[model samples]
Each structure stands twice: as C-alpha cells, then as structure tokens.
Target: MATKTDDPKVLAQNRKANHDYFIEDTVEAGIVLTGTEIKSIRQGKANLRDSFVRIQSGEAWLINCHISHFEHGNRFNVDPTRTRKLLLHRTQIDKLFGQMKEKSYALVPLKIYLKNGFAKVLLGLAKGKKNYDKRQDVAKKDAQRDIDRALRDRQKY
Candidate 1:
C-alpha cells in the first residue's frame, strides 16, 4: 500500500537540480500541452533535465523540457523542445519575478507529474550553488552513507 505522501505518478524528474541549486521554495504549476504531447507524457516519455522556468510579462514559461513525440502521433507531433507556457496565478508570477531579479537566483523545473488527471510541473525558486558547495555535498553524502553502513553492520551482529 502506498502512503498518501507518495507521489501519484512522476513522469520525469530533474535530479541534478537539487545538486546544482539551493531550492528556497516550490510551486505547482499547470503546463499547457498539445494533444499528442500529453499522450507522450502519459507514457512517461518526458525529460526535465536542462529545463528551466522563466517568469516574463506576468507569466511563467517552461523552456527546454522535452516531451517525446508520440509513437503514433505522425504529423500531429510538435517540436519536442518547444517552449511551453506555465499556468500560474498573477500573484505567483509576480513573486517569482521578484525572486529572479536577485543575483544567482533562478526558476527551475524540478519535476513533472500528473495530478488529478492534469499535468503539473514542480517549479523551484533556486539559487545556484558554487563548485565548492557541490563538492561539500558529495562529501557529506559519502560520510552519511558510511555511517548508515556502520549502523547496519552493528545491528546484524
């Protein structure tokens, strides 16, 4: 049995985003998709890597996110890398625009998933991490993994 905290069905995730930036906040926004595009997404053929969100003209847009063309789409398929608009409230757009003005801050797409039969994107308010920060994170993870291994060994004794 899956817990309520578990996600419904994640289509694609930008795992590198967590390592590259400090996510200050997350917002759920709807994505405007064409008919064939949604079909491809439903089949889990989507990629969030290299994708970023931009707030412009009181709206949010998703760039570089790829939803693969449906196998049967034929001539109906659109460009995989086409920019798509993100549906967000005016206030939310305003907030994102404000945060984006700060140095090194960015709007990034963390994950894409289906919710209540609609496609949603998890948008993050992120600040890029320095090279040293990434190295430190790796070292911290390695240390934590070692500690977990030690605990498991002790428990098995």
Candidate 2:
C-alpha cells in the first residue's frame, strides 16, 4: 500500500476549458467531498468538463462537475454531477464576483490534485480567446515544436 503521495488520485480535469479559454489567473480552493466521493476520486473517475463557477450569497459553487460514484459505494453514494460548494475567503469571492461581471472573465477549473491528504481544485479566472487568438497560439506552439526538433536534430551531428 502506498501513501497519499503515491495514491492514484486525480478526480477530474477540464482540458476543454483550457483550449477554449485564456487562463488569466488561478486560485486553489477546497472542495466539499463525501466519503464515497473521495473513493471514486482516488480511482480517477471524475469529469470537470462543462463545469463553471458561480458566486451567490457571498459563496462560490462549482456546477456541472461529474464525480462518479464508487462502484461498491452503495446507497450512500451521492449524485455524480452535483453542484459542489467551494471554500474561499469573502474578500476573494467578492473580487471574483466583480471580475465575473466583466464580459470576458469566466470561471474555469484547471485541475484537481490531492494535497496533504485533502482534495483541492485549482480554479482559474479566464477570458475566452477569439478564433484568431487560438489560431495564433496554435501557430506559435507549432513553431516552438519545430525549433525544438531542429535543435535536437543539430545535437545528433
């Protein structure tokens, strides 16, 4: 048996959000998780696609994230895609709410990682990228890859 550090944990990730949004800033927040939920997460059975954050009544919540129930979890298992609450300070919530009011800023979950035996969600304040911006980013990545390939090839000479 491995320790928590070696625990196969990674509940969910939002890969599409990264592709569609330009991540401006990120914040790590604690998630309200249940026993069975934790088991499922440790098994890597969660999805963060289509999830978004909404602040209401001075609290932040994550919506549309799907954390599948553990197979042997029985009746105690909760819904997979339940709206989960996020733990954050009031000032941070207020600041995020203000930024969300802007037309471009959107809330996105970057990754889920286990820290100190607790589950943590890495959230991002993102701005949607225009089509051209995405194309330019792709082109830049391609160019960088080419440069790396060229340098590696040079090393062989």
Backbone Cα, N, C clashes tallied per candidate: 0, 0
32-150 in candidate 1: lDDT tens per residue? 99999999999999999899987767778899998899999999999999999999999889877877885557999999898877899999999989999999999999999999999
CA lDDT of every candidate: 0.91, 0.87
lDDT of 2 by residue, 49-86 (tens): 88899888889999998998899999999989998999
- TM-score for every candidate vs. truth? 0.94, 0.91
Instruction: Summing lDDT over every window of 10 consecutive residues in candidate 1, give the lowest-scoring window.
Output: 1-10
Q: Candidate 2 — which residues are off by over 4 angstroms?
A: 1-11
